[model samples]
Target: MHKFIVHGGRPLSGTIKPKGSKNEALQVMCATLLTEAIVTINNIPDITDVHSVMQLLTLLGVQIVPLGKGSYQFCAAHLHTDVTLTEIFRQEYAKVRGSIMLLAPLLVRFKSVSVPKPGGDRIGRRGVHAHFEGLERLGVTFCYNVDEEAWKAKCTTLSGSYILMPEPSVTGTANIVMAASMAKGKTIIYPAACEPHVQQLCHMLVAMGATITGIGSNILTIEGVAHLSGTVHTILPDMLEIGSFIGLAAATKSTLTITDVPINLFTPVWSCFRKLGIRLEEDDNSLHIPFQPSYHIQKEIDGNLLSLSDAVWPGIPADLISIAIITAVHAHGHILIHQKMFESRLFFVDHLIEMGARLILCDPHRVHVVGLGNAYRLRGTRMSSNDIRAGITLLIAALAAEGTSTIANIHQIDRGYEQIDQRLNALGASIERA
Candidate 1:
């Protein structure tokens, strides 16, 4: 167990670049199993989830060579193992949801994949039915043994068709895309998740000789290919991290210049932030978050209070809803945060309430936060992290609070943010990880 001991009431001032996207790197790595050629991925995030994916790949007989820090060359060309070492990696994989992606590639190439129940944030019921349902559209059969707590899916040749996902689940969409890329004929996916990470995986597949249209749209067209060769691709910057930093700067009144932000990748995200009174500046390859006025929630067109809710890609991300909630606490007016994607994600607000936040928990999926408007600073207090995003949001609140605060169970934070304590320390934040 690790903890972050933070001396609060300090405004972090300096520039910091976010690490690569963890979500993107996981999908890219899983996509490698679809091909026999060497795939080189750059800008990989040095996070626990990624390392677990790498471990899973190695267990499947793929050779992963380190090109440098945050870079790797993966070759599954000679992979011979059919048995997924799920038992060895089960505990680790249980820490991140992206581990479920292994099923598609394994089922495609080897005909069978056995995996333990995938684990991630305990936010809500994340069903694998989307993945199974989508893959079944391509001729895959699934069997689950409840007593063993494992699932096995097998398929011969996948026949492509139209797949309408129950929800725009990001990992589910990636699994389907990977499976469809190698199936016979063409496959169409409707109501797909078009997040930047999903887009990057689609582009990487295309670079490896897979045909995929509708790069940034809800409808995706993937034409099956006989074979795919390895190619070099760079993972996109972590937009979630970028958004978190934006919130951090606003909460602490700091100016931060983030480089290589992939500005176009974040138009919708920035627009959502603007609705909350957080303004951002963009350049060709960078984004600047300057000190702004005290934040406030915008009113609705009908002159009623509006709530900030998360949806699929193009809409606000559900993962950032917690950070948005914390940002709203420091803003001027009250706003509702509807975490439609998850049930328990809003439970972390109780910690904020302890720090003197004016919040009303409407339900498991919604909360209303009324900002203190710079009139009151959150008082420091001991807390525990319940999930990744909430953990980071608590850290942010701790940094903005008065006096000292201790956060336990920091491994939850390490699973997502790489060297978060060190990175924040570099930005003049008084935090120690022990």
Candidate 2:
């Protein structure tokens, strides 16, 4: 257990690079299990959740070698197909929700596998029905064991079929595509998540000899291949991290240059921030957030309160809603933040209110924020980090507050962001992890 002692009132200014996409890295790492050849992955984020997934893969007998910074070589040539729900596997795999994705590749290669119920940030109820439903469409059968308290899936061979997902689930879509890569016949998935990470996974599978179409759309068609050959893939920059940084820069009135950002993927994020009257400059390979006194939250054309909410892909990312809420406190006008996906995500607004920012939690899914603007400064205080997104948001708010603040449960932040305390400290912020 670690806590961050952050001395507020210091503005962060420097060039900092975003780490590899954590969401993309997890799916890409699991893709290694679909092949016998060596799979080399670049720009892998060194975060806790990703490391947990790597440990899970190692337990499944996949050989993984660390080839220096942000690079890994994985080979499932001598993979062990059998997975018993041992205490060790349960303890490790339950720390990362991405561990559930292992079932897809394992079932495709070995026909049967056991997996514990996935565990991760308790932001909301994240059901796995979409994953099981998609798998069943591919000729897979799964059952839960009462005594073992684990899921058991069995299949002799998967014959692809059309799967219309109940929702556009990101991880669920990735799981189905991975399992369908080697299944017989063709698999068509409708209403699939078109998130950037999901698209990245599809591209990687295509490179490994799988035939896939509809790269960036809700409809995906995959023609099963006999087998896949390993290929090298590079992860894009972490967009969530980039959004957090942008919020931090705006909240603290700091000038920051974020290098190597994937600007091509910023249309949705940029549009959302623009609604808050926040502007950023983009270069060929970097994003520049200049120091400004404050931004005025823009109202609707009819002068109604601006509402920012999250939806499926191309929507304001659910992960960034927390940061946006914190950023809203420092802006000039009021904004309504609706976190529709996670019911409990708005509960963290109480801590922001504790810091002297005016916020009303309308419900579990909606929050009404009244910006204090530059005329009033938030008074910092002790707070507990409830989840990954909220932890970083609290950290950003603390940096923009008036006094020192203590943030406990920083491990939540570490699960996604790599060396965040050290990296933020490098940007002239006084954050000590203890």
Task: State which candidate has the highest lDDT.
Answer: 2
- How high is each candidate's TM-score? 0.97, 0.98
Superposed on all Cα atoms, model 2 deviates from the true structure by an RMSD in Å of 0.9
Q: Write down the TM-score for model 1.
A: 0.97
Q: Write the per-residue lDDT of candidate 2 for residues 159-201, one digit (tens) a residue.
A: 8899999999999999999988889999999999999999999
Q: What pairs collide in candidate 2? A: none
Q: List the global CA lDDT of all models.
A: 0.87, 0.90
In model 2, where do residues sit more than 4 Å from their true spots? none
Q: What is the C-alpha local distance difference test score of candidate 1?
A: 0.87
Model 1 Cα lDDT, one tens digit per residue, 231-336: 9999888989988888888887778888878887788778777777887888788888888658777889998988788988788998888889888888888788
**Which ten-residue region of model 2 has the weakest summed lDDT?**
78-87
Best by TM-score: 2
